[model samples]
Target: MKYVVTTVWKHPVKIDWQSMRQTMSKSKDNPHVAEIHWYEIDETTHGSVAIYHSRDAYEANLAFMQEHRSNSISERGIEMFPRSAW
Candidate 1:
């Protein structure tokens, strides 16, 4: 079955929108990726939906994503802060 992942994160500080778009666009480099879309959840939050070929594909992507996160998001001081509205 296809695997779909939804993620939401917050940027306590200013965000580099161009870099965000570039990073997201790189998701297309993964052959297992079916579709991915990014959106603004609110003023400080962003969300994304990713569809993979299967659970296996999703799991594989998870590993790649972790490394990418460390190299890009983490390096940029981005934090996935807890949602206060919850």
Candidate 2:
């Protein structure tokens, strides 16, 4: 199973992308995480999408969110469907 975790936040001061990257780098030992990806929108929209592989997707998502306190996080499961038969 793959879970997507999205984080949104407003910084009191200008966000230092370098510091943020360093923070994320420290979580290399997190068991509930598989891959962490990030993106930014226009300006205020700053968020990260994390993909996790676990038997319990919901719990895994919650655990990841708990680790990061500065931002608001939301998690959703990804579902795929077959488009055609060969």
Candidate 3:
């Protein structure tokens, strides 16, 4: 399954891509995250579309979000199609 995780942080200055990358690196252990693509919507908003192999992966991601409150997930959507040109 594919999920589009959209988040808007109040403090754009605190947007730490490196930290997020590090956190995502732990996906090797989580194993649900197949791939992730992040986007900067604006100065204070960003989003990520992730591909999960199974429901376990999707739930794990949600659990992680609940535990980590630094980023505010304002909107979340499931992706019907998974493809990219870049």
Which candidate ranks first by TM-score, i.e. highest?
Answer: 1
lDDT of all the models against the reference? Answer: 0.72, 0.52, 0.53
Please give the ranking of all candidate structures by TM-score, highest first, separated by commas.
1, 2, 3
lDDT of 2 by residue, 1-86 (tens): 66655555544445567866887786556677777765654354456666666646537556554544513232222112221111
Give the deviation of candidate 2 from the true structure as CA RMSD.
9.1
RMSD of each: 4.3, 9.1, 7.6
Query: lDDT ranking from best to worst?
Result: 1, 3, 2
Please, what's the RMSD in Å of model 1?
A: 4.3
Candidate 3 shows a clash count of: 0
Residues 7-68 of candidate 3: C-alpha lDDT, one tens digit per residue: 33343254566876786676556566667666666554456566677656677677775654
- Least well predicted 10-residue stretch by lDDT in candidate 2: 77-86
Error of 1 at 52 (Å): 0.6
Q: Write the per-residue lDDT of candidate 1 for residues 1-86, one digit (tens) a residue.
A: 88887777777765567877987787788898898888887766787777888988877777877786566456755555432210
lDDT: which candidate is best?
Answer: 1
